[model samples]
Every structure is written in C-alpha cells, then in structure tokens.
Target: MKFKITHITTYLFDSEVFLEPHYLRFRPSQTSYVNVSELALTILPQPAGHKMVQDEDNNSVDFCWFEGMTSQLTIKAESVLETKPYNPFNFLIYPQNFNTLPFQYNVLQKKLLFSALEVVPISKVLSDYALSILQRSNFNTIPYLTNLTKQLHDDFSVEYRADGAPFIPDETFQLKRGSCRDLSWMLINVLRQQGLAARFVSGYYYFDMVKPAYELHAWVDVYLPGIGWFGLDPSHGILTGNTHFPIASSAHYEHTMPVSGGIRGSASSKLNTELIIEKL
Candidate 1:
C-alpha cells in the first residue's frame, strides 16, 4: 500500500518571544517493511539554522534553531511512502526457553535492554490485572501479550487528548479510559512488570478510509531475542503491521514527542494541529 500524509502544527503566542532550538521527529522512519520515497519539512519564520540528524534511538530528527522573535511558529511535514504487507506474527521467539511468560532475558540481551526493562512501581490492582491475563493465556508469552492488548482495548474507552503527558498506569487502570499515549505507557509498565523489555513508540497509523483526519499514534514495542523489537498496539488491540509508520521510539515517552523545545519569554501559547492521511 502507498500513502500520502501531511501534518501541520502551529503555535500562537500572545506576544513575540525568542524561539528556542527545537527537535522535530516528523520524518517517517524507513524500515525493512516501509519505504520512504519522498519527504519535505517546512517551517515558518524561516529558521536560521537547520540540520537533519539521527538521535540516540535511531529516529530521524530535524534540528532547527531560530534567531528572531516571533509571535507564532508553524511546522508542516509531507511524505509519500509505500508499505509491504506481511504477517505480524511471522517470526518465532528465540531461545525456546524464553517462549513462556515470566522468563528473563540472557545476560547480553538484558544489558542492552536495561532501560526498556526498568520497571516502575505499579499498584497491586495493575499487577493483578496483568497476572489475570497471564493466567488466562496459560503463561504463554505470545498469548499473554495478545490477551493483554485485547483486554485493554475492550475494557477501556479511548479519549482524544491532543496534548498532555500520559497519565500514570494505575490512574489509567482505575479510570478505565485514556488517550493512546496513556494506554501505551500503561502497557509499557505492564510489560515491564512481567520482566519484558518494552518501550514507547510514536508514529502515524493509517486506517483504510477516505482522506480521514489523523493524529500521531502511540504504541508499545517489546524486545524479543530472536525477532528483535516487535510492536503491539493496545489502542487497537492488534499487532502493528505495515500501516504503522514509526517516527520515534524510546524507553520514556517524553523523549518520543513529535516536537520538543521551549521559548525564551513567558508568553502564553495556543497550539493547533491538522493531519491528513490519504491512501494512494
């Protein structure tokens, strides 16, 4: 499948303020299953300096620094890409002994995935909730992940929150509803609780529709020895496939934000975003 996507973000400040250097993670990541044929990024009040670079997580970033004061800032990104279809579950788990739930990674794997494996203190309710899914899946790793993703999707209501940090896992669990990032973050903690190395992923999700409005999507990526990093979307209760175009991923969600920077003045700001995804 081929796609054309346009995403625009604008910030309006009450007064002119010095624009600080910003990191933009808008370029679609080129992966084994996805090809990026074309991509363009536009910034208003033309930046004084700009460079395209890769971050520690291997995400493409547009680093821009501005020199003048401005009352508003605008960024627009456009891309055309093609994705290959493949079975999301085509791979096998490595080291057969690690195919079950509550299994630990080997020494080398553990050292590399240390950050992703760091567990946050979760409430008993959340732990019990994850354990219930584990038991239901008969302590099988694949089934446990599938059931956990499906259960989260079925039991929680998805809310459209354009901005804000993710809510804590326990809070989201108690509320039974959250934005995609909140759910993904919750899922990451849940996986960590089970001794799995999971990280936060931010990207674009293409649903088959007629020029539908879209937003940046969030999901979880679990590291398995043999298959490497695999994506699971609790928001949709499905394994991520070709339609999932990742921009950035990190052990912490904040690091994966599409835009990160600050201003030099205390001017209040209003943010607006528009996204369009079309299938070609």
Candidate 2:
C-alpha cells in the first residue's frame, strides 16, 4: 500500500536564545521497502543553520544550531512511497529464542556500530518485570501479541514530548508502561539481559482505538536465528507489523533518537516543541 506521510515539528521558547542546536531525523528514510522524496528541514538559526546525517547506515541526523537569536527549531517532512512490510502473526516464520544471537552481550563490543540501543545503556542489571518480559516461554502468556499483529483500523495514541531519562529496569517494571520509545527500549534491554539479542526501533505507531496518525515512535525486534528479528511493543503489548515504517534502530533510544546534538550558547533554556503528524 502507498502511504503519504507528513511530519512537522515546531519549537518555541521563553526568550531570545543564543544557540538552538538540534538533530533532524525528520527526513523519511529510504529503506528496503520504503522510498523518501521531497524532504527538507528549515531552522531559524542566527548566523547559519545546516543538517547532516549522524549515521548513514541507519539513517539518523546529527543536526545543530551554530548561532541564532530566535528560540525555535522547526522540522517538516513529507514523502510519497509504497511499503511491503513483513507480517509476524499468520506467517509464524520463526520463534524467538534469544539464547544465541549476535551481540547478545556487551552490545557495543562489536564495531561500535551505533543503533537506537547504543544511545542507552542496556548492560545494567535487569529487574524482575523487564526480565519477565523476556522470560515468557509460552507465547500464550502475551496478552495481546497474537491478535493485534493483524488488528488494524483501531485507534491509537501518538504522544509527542521530550524529557530527562527515566529510571531503567526498576521503575519500568512497576508501571509496565512508558512512552513509546521507553517501551521499545525497555523491552530491548530486557531481552538483552536474558541473553536474547534485541535492538531498539524508531518510527511511528497508532496508540489504541486512536488513529495511526503519529509523529515519531520507538519499539524493539529480537533475533530468533531461524525467523530473524521479530518486533514487539511491550508498552502497547502488541507486535509491530507492516504499517510500522521503521526509520532506524539501535541497542538504545539515545542511539536511535530522531535528533541529537550540542549547542554553543543555549545551555539552560526551556525548549518547547509542537509536533503535527498527519496521514494524507
């Protein structure tokens, strides 16, 4: 199916700022089954503003604001393309084992290949809840994993906000909930703790009974050797499927962030962002 995707992000601040550095992952990626066209980012930088690819292999931006008087970072992205995603329910191609997958431990021990997970530390001790998410042997234990893989036309909540990092493994276990990226990253770390190879995913997803219309999102996909990487969203308690156009992934959310960079002068400034994602 062909999908027209449009994502816009606007930032507002309290007063005139010196620097407004930011990364722009607003650009739709050209993946195996997705194509990107008509992509651009406009920043209100004081002296000059430009964007660059943070990682070409995974498709992320290391954007920044050199010098600016304004206090806003606006990013707009749109594209026309078709998607041929792989389904996980009916096919049941491979079962997840996590016991033996590449980079199961010391996730960054390899070539230091950066991914969504690499940004976050997944090597820490595991909590009961995060560990339980991976310990499930019987797929039947997963509340909605089987059914929702194909259940579409349902409403979903698309949240857009940023903040300081949350307590890992500990807090996530009690709530069994978090932002989209948190859910994705938490699960990825959980799987890693149990010797299962997992990675972080960044993209967009429909909340619940809400519309699929969303800005940016995060999830996880674990390698099961035979079946390859299968996606799961512990937050929503569902498996990611065809409609989920993956932008990029890593061992942690920080690595898979849509944007990341440092500013020159704007150190302690309140950053406000308005994100509008529409499906046309």
Best by TM-score: 1
Query: Judged by lDDT, which candidate is best?
Result: 1
The digit string of per-residue lDDT tens for model 2 on 238-276 reads 677666667776565566666566444443555544444
For candidate 1, write residues 85-179 as lDDT tens digits: 77888898878877887898878888889999999899998999999889989999888888899999999999899999999999999999999
- Considering summed lDDT, which 10 consecutive residues are worst modelled in model 1? 206-215
Instruction: Tally clashing residue pairs in candidate 1.
Output: 0
Measured with C-alpha atoms, the lDDT of residue 129 in candidate 1 is 91
Scored by lDDT, model 1 comes in at 0.92
For candidate 2, the per-residue lDDT at 178 reads 55
Clashing pairs in 1: none
* Residue 123, model 1, lDDT: 98
